[model samples]
Target: MSLHADAWSTLASWRPDYYTQEALRQAFLGYLAARPDACQRSCAAGHITASALVFDAGGEHLLLTLHPRVGKWVQLGGHCEPSDSTLAGAALREATEESGIADLRIDPVPVHVDVHPITCSLGVPTRHFDVRFAVRAPRGAHPVRSAESLDLRWWPVDALPDEDGELDMMLAVLR
Candidate 1:
């Protein structure tokens, strides 16, 4: 199947309750179904993407990307391209590309999957069905900023800045 077609099929196959809650899942699905363009581009067009939450041993330190757009400390991730065969692979690719980490190991199970509306720099509305994975970086591996981020750092999980609801949710799931 084509990338777009596969995305649409994946979205259609998701049970409403399979997401966080019945109401939330239904609402999101309903919104997607309402907009044929969004549905088509998001699912069928292969615009869906994934991310990773890389944690240090003991899970006390969290790896975060200094997003160039938002200028906030956030997880490493980006759009899923055709090269990525699965959501996990896409997320891992983003993690490696953004962080410059070569030996990263991502947990197969998704820690969480969040779908939300995003307006990029061009002010175009797009949906992000972020399949968040848990990953571990080799000890002493320090990530350098690529074009996607301004910096990369390991922050104490408890000392994260108070911003971005998605980051909070990601941390909660990691805990």
Candidate 2:
């Protein structure tokens, strides 16, 4: 199946744990039904993005990157690629690329979804329909900071600088 179809099927079959998440899932399905090119960045209105919240081997620390463009600490992820076959795969790929850490294990199930506006590489403002997943880092994992980020570090989950509580929300739904 196509990546777009995989996204639709995934969301359609997922049973969100919260009412808010259910609403987001419905919104994603509706958006996908209306826009065939919704997974592509060229959609102009918005596009699907895959991201991962990386947990340490022991699950105490969460890896985050200070995005150079947004200048805010955010999870590792980006726009979906044509080569991606599944949303989980796209998210895992992004996490590996941004964190520079291999052998990360993805949950396959979505942990969260968000919509936000940004002027990305397209040079115009657009909304990002973000699909988030949980990923586990290997033991003694050493992260290499990518040029895409201003800084990369593992922050204690309890003391995260998540101003919007996005990270907390992602973690909360899992438990």
Candidate 3:
């Protein structure tokens, strides 16, 4: 199946843990149905981006990147590429590429979905329909910074550099 079709299928059957998440899932599916190019960056309006929130093996800390574009500490994720076969693959790929950590494992099911506007590399204002998934890094894994981030490190979940409601919501639902 195509990436777009795969995303549709994934969301179509997805069972969000919260009411708000369920709403986002429904809205995202509607958006995809209306915009066939929603999975590609060339859409010129908005596109689906995949991300992973990487938690330590013991779940004590989560890895975050100081994103150069957003200038804030956030999860590791980015725009979907043509090489990615599914949204989950895109999230895992971004996490691996940005974290530079080996033996990372990603949960196929999404943890959250967010829609935010930004002036992307396309040089135009657009919305990023971000799909977030939970990932776990190997014990004693070390991360190397990538060009996409100004800094990358593991932060205690209770003392994050920035407030991430999405993470909180996911944690509440998962735990």
Candidate 4:
């Protein structure tokens, strides 16, 4: 099926009150509809995963990863495995594995839900239904990078690497 069709299907499964979710869904659908070959395969049917935009207790900094694939700084997240019963569980797992921080805790509420299409290093396209949660880490918690990231650091929320539009969007959400 087309990416637009897949986005619509995914959006329909989510709660409609979330403006970010709807907006992202529409944006992705529009992009896909405009470019049928944007992605190698439609990820509309893939299992959704959770992610954390973790900030220190001071809230002045946010944990970010320089992704091994995209080579962009982003929140901690990955695919949902069959063992993960909930999106939050999958996100927490990815966060701990990638960042090597065991004390991270997500707030009870979700910060945002975003659905976006990404092209892998091989130029294969896939969709990610990222349920973003807000989290607070203990002061002075150091991050250790895993294979998924080239580097991991806590960046000041006000100062982020200047790059693509996607980074700006993510920063806005993180802010």
Candidate 5:
């Protein structure tokens, strides 16, 4: 099946835990149906972005990136690339790229979905239909900071930033 078809199937099969999540899932499906280039960065209307909450081997620490533009410690993820064939693959690629850790293992099942506004590099405001999954780092994995982030660090899952509701929600589902 095509990547676009695969994405639709993934979202269709997901059972969200909250009303908002279900709404987002439906909205994403609708967006995909309406826009053939939903996964492309130039999709202007809106695009599907993939992200992953990466945990260390012990599962005690989560790798977060200090996003330069948003100025928030967020998960490793970004726009879907043309080479990506699946949402899970996009999320894993983002995790590996942003964290500079190539040995990460991503769970194919998404843990959460969120829709939020973002200013694209082209200076256009667009919504990102974010699909989030859980990914695991290799044992003794040490992360290097990539150019995409101002800094990269591992945080205790319980002590995540209070303002990051997305992280909180993800942790709630993961735990």
Candidate 6:
């Protein structure tokens, strides 16, 4: 199946909260319909990004990265590469690459969807229609910071920084 078809299927299966159900579904369907290159970075109108909210084996803590450019602690994710077959695969690949933990297991279902504007170093401001999934890290896993992040740390799920909206989104999905 095409990546776009996979994204459509994934979104169709997601059961988002009442607050986001209609908006998320509409945003995803619109993305698929309006942009043929929705999976690629060049889609200036907006593009689909995949992210993983990673928790430890026992679910006590969440792994977050301080994004260098964005200057905020956020979930592990990035642009969808051509090699990724599904949004879940893109999220898992991003988590593995950003956290340096190879044994992460990602739930195939999307837990949340968000549309937010961002301006990368290369282009004009664009929106990231992010499909987020939950990932459980290996027991006793140790994560090393990648070049994409300024720092990497495991924050207790209950003690996450309140300033980061991404944390709130994660908490909502995990609950």
Top lDDT prediction, candidate number: 2
Clash count per candidate: 1, 0, 0, 0, 0, 0
**lDDT tens digits, residue span 1-175, model 6:** 8888899888877767656655877778877987889988888878999999999999999999998878888889999988888999999999999999978999998888888899964479998998888999999999999999999999999888759566775687568
Q: After superposition, how far is residue 44 of candidate 3 from its true place, in Å?
A: 1.4
Using alpha carbons, what is the TM-score of model 1?
Answer: 0.74
> Could you give candidate 5's per-residue lDDT for residues 8-78 as a string of tens digits?
99999998778878888898999999999998889887888999999999999999999998999999898
Backbone collision tally, model 3: 0
Q: On residues 132-166, what C-alpha lDDT tens digit does candidate 4 reach at each position?
A: 66777877888888988889998887787747655
Best by TM-score: 2
**106 in model 2: Cα distance from truth in Å?**
0.4
TM agreement with the true structure for every prediction: 0.74, 0.97, 0.95, 0.69, 0.95, 0.95
Candidate 1 local lDDT, 1-175, one digit each (tens) = 5544444555455543234634544554555456444423345422355788987755777789887777678888877675655666777888888888788898765666677667654357766655578888887887888887788888887887647577776667556
Model 3 / residue 147 / CA error / Å: 0.3
Q: Give the least accurate 10-residue stretch of model 5, judged by summed lDDT.
A: 161-170
- Tell me how candidate 2 scores on lDDT: 0.93
Q: For residues 71-156, could you state the per-residue lDDT of candidate 2 as single tens digits? A: 88899999899899899999999999999999999999898898989999899999999999999999999999988899999999
Off by over 4 Å in 1: 1-46, 121-123
TM-score (C-alpha) between model 6 and the true structure: 0.95
lDDT leaderboard ranking:
2, 3, 5, 6, 1, 4
Candidate 5 colliding pairs: none
Distance (Å) between predicted and true CA of 73, model 1?
1.4
Where does candidate 2 have its weakest 10-residue lDDT segment?
166-175
lDDT of each: 0.67, 0.93, 0.90, 0.65, 0.89, 0.87
Residue 101's lDDT within candidate 1 is 79
Residues 11-115, model 3: lDDT tens digits:
888898789889989999999999999999988889999999999999899999998888888989999999988999999999999999988998888888889
| Candidate 3 runs further than 4 Å off | 164-166
